[model samples]
Target: MIGLNLRLHWIYVPYLSSGRSIRLQINTVIMNPNLDDVDRKILRELQTDGRASFRDISSRIGVSTPTVSARVQAMTDMGLIKGYSTLLDADMLGQVSVILTINAKPSHLEDVYERLMEDEMVRQIFILSDSRLLCMLSFYNQVKYKMFIETISKIPEILSMDASMILKAPKENQRAALTDEAGLLIRCYYCGHMIHDEGVKIKMDGKYHYLCCPVCSKLYKEKYEKLRKSA
Candidate 1:
């Protein structure tokens, strides 16, 4: 959480249901997170439900939607909310999803993302400040876990990677705080798409509504303009 003063390559990308893929340049986006209690609360609520309407967040936070919107915008401008993701029923999806902790060569962290990102089955991955790594990956449940582990072990940069099956609670639960980048990436400024960083990703400006990007912001302005004139 601290000392990310180091520059990183962060990439914004799209999540596709049709099996289409988009390659992204992963930059280490330093999160200079500054939060008040309300900002934290807004994040908590949003984390629970990415699609929660702005009206709902405003009501819960006891502020007007515009005020909630303003604060969310400010937080996003500051890079607090990294993304939002849909919590999928991995088992239902018929692919085996498990948590893998990799202790690849510390210097090889970038290489890990570079090589690992090439695999479509690799869902979500993270790099630890302590030079360790953790990833959530899903493939055929029928495939032996060790076989997959062995395949990765072949990577010259991988020091050691261990993976285990994770059990999902029947109901949703909050993960203990490690860091808070995941909550902000839910809003997209383009095409009104809302993504939960379930696997792929996008970017944000979210108090209650999602801001896709600068272009989407302009599109929103024009969209409302057309609406106003038509009315």
Candidate 2:
């Protein structure tokens, strides 16, 4: 099958007393596996409400409940649907949130990243194009926040660190918008290569697997079987 570009538009309402909402729209380009219209509809419904029931989606999308369930399961197996989560408000929980921009020496970038990952206060991390690390951290109070910063200051690999307190978040959206041009991209299960076309699909151990070529497919199957036997 060929690739497709999908566009998705949805409304996002944050769970706050501010009585605010935002309309999010974006065009998503999905590479490597083919997704039909039915699949797109299912995704749109789920992205709008992760807790939406199968029957609810079926009624809205004009599909059967079984079809919706099966399609969701298939997409989940393909690693397209990671999982669902509930968004929580840090401000409501009386937590101090801070954004930390850390610049580490090129030679010790990975080491510094791992060190930060071990800290319980770190919530999220992103690597910027300039090799700087952007970290989102949360602490219960100012005391804990100060202690955490003091500890991080001693890390020799860290060249510079800047911290900014988040006073307020007017809008927060964890869900991504899908457009007609958006498609889900899947990688080869064995080689980790992006699949541009309909690659070989294999099902083993009740799980779906995709491979870029026949050679990798054979090798992956053999390895899987050997590991299963050893287990």
Candidate 3:
């Protein structure tokens, strides 16, 4: 069973269609900085109310407004904070939810994955251990659901698919309890490599940037300065 304390977040890509985008979630742990007291406090506040202003969070946490703002921005740049979203009552909206377990041949997995990404009803997708995919799909009614099934059935890459409807969600969108041990996944801004140690850190444009080495730091700084100068 998944623990309630584990944070569920999505990393969004550039592919957008029909006012919806494909989101990929990372399930494995990555090495980075652990959360501090102030960081935890700010995340907790925002998790409770995403729309809370930085001033309100500062007052509640007994920190200055500027500090709250800076921390939030830094976290956002670091990808620790993915993005904000509003919760909606799917039941009231007459939306049907289903979980799809999909299996594709090794040679055609990417083809099948791309086809699914074009579907607006496909909300979330997870790559499983055995090279299968677990997808969450939403639809307005049975008619649309049947249509989607028929459409995907024509795809040759998808070997098999199993679907299970979600009848009810007893606890949905549970907030992650930010603890001191919680770590942020850091990556090199220049080389796009994961930083496993105390990597180089530099502040530019009022935001902190991480690099895996001194060489990367130098290169990233030069590139950033060039971009800024051109701008």
Query: Tens digit of lDDT per residue, candidate 2, span 1-231?
Result: 233344342436453577786554432333357778888889988888999999999999899999898888878977778899897889889999999999988888889899999988899998876668999999999999999999988999898999999999887765366778777677887899987765666677788787765556666777899999999
Candidate with maximal TM-score: 2
TM-score of each: 0.53, 0.79, 0.74
- Supply the global lDDT for candidate 1: 0.61
Over the stretch 163-221, how does candidate 1's per-residue lDDT look in tens digits?
78766646646554624443334435447475332212223333232333334444455
TM-score of 2: 0.79
Model 1 TM-score is 0.53
Candidate 1 worst ten-residue window by lDDT: 198-207
Clashes of each: 23, 15, 0
Rank order (by TM-score, best first): 2, 3, 1
